[model samples]
Target: MSVGSENLPQFALVGGKGTGKSSLLESLVGKDFLPRGATRAPLVLNLRKSDCQEQGIFLHRPGEKIHDFSRIREEIANRTVILAGLVRLSLDCQPDNFVEQTKSTIMEYISKEETIILAVTAEGLVMSQALEQAMMVDPEGARTIGVITKLDRAQDIAMAELDNKVVPLKWGHVGVVLRSEAVKCWKY
Candidate 1:
């Protein structure tokens, strides 16, 4: 099927800084392609499932279409790209103004009825700004799915949230424990 012909499920990852949004994306793609640090603009990853040995990865920036596989990661990390697929909007919870801007951008998508994956740190679940924004926009939890990050840091609290005892949602919550830089070097 052609890209535009079929209606693919679009997921939007929304969260504040240090909330593991990029790490979740990396885990989904099974690669560490996204650059480390904060993202300036929203990223739309057009991922296609295929059986081919080699898959094509393209990055379309404003005024240029990049086809070089080696440059895809760098290009996406360095600048913004516009495409149609899964959208991930990072909320930088710093300097105050940026947070408001991020919230506005997220509201635009929410108005469009996009599926929202609200990322919240396990330790800060009750006070997570990301969760607050999501609940404010989607009080009924119709399109919001809470993602509890840093589960390893606070398993008990994360479990409570996952059980919906802390904050209930219609779609429910998912807990993810991503390895930190310090744990990356250690063996199982």
Candidate 2:
């Protein structure tokens, strides 16, 4: 793994809302609870509000300078990372260049394994191309893992489609949101 040398194993949680993704991370780490759309400004605001909480998570907000990456890197170097809620530039971003740069930054830092889990929120729409690009950015194959969230919400998808289209393609890596007590051990 070559990460932290002494801390916990790093993992990335990517999926849509109501998938219990945030709930899962909160349950696992017990700290650094960064909700989806955790931009840099709100993080700074939250950091200031905390005043002196030792344990915290650092996430990148869109419209921030790359030099701000130092704080995030320092946090990772110190092993304070729990989870990262990535802010996709495509959301409400006007200039195409900014979005492209944002994507570049995500790919760049992910390569260093700064945060354990790159938790992406898919939220109904299949952001497959975006995920593919992110994974492909890591040429060494940094153990890509993902979860297909909100299964409970997709009643229109049908059981037959679920069995064939969804299950076969997603079984190994993607976890369908099935509410059962016995179904645990979800790390993929």
Top candidate on TM-score is 1
Give the lowest summed-lDDT range of ten residues in model 2.
Answer: 40-49
For this target, which candidate reaches the highest lDDT against the unseen true structure? Answer: 1
Q: Give lDDT tens digits, candidate 2, residues 64-164.
A: 33323345445443332232223444344334465466456555545544434343333422345434544554433344444444444553533333333
Q: Rate the local accuracy (lDDT) of all candidates.
A: 0.60, 0.40
Clashing residue pairs, backbone N/CA/C < 3 A, model 2: 11-116, 11-117, 12-117, 12-118, 13-119, 14-120, 15-122, 16-122, 16-123, 40-61
Candidate 1 lDDT over 1-188, as tens digits, reads 46641244556677766778778776766765666666545555455445643333343433344444346577666554332112243334334355456567677665555455554555746788677777777887787777777767777666667776667777777777674742221111
Off by over 4 Å in 1: 1-8, 49-70, 80-99, 122-124, 181-188
Score residue 177 of candidate 1 by CA lDDT: 68
In the order shown, the candidates' Cα RMSDs to the true structure are 6.8, 9.9
Using alpha carbons, what is the TM-score of model 2? 0.43
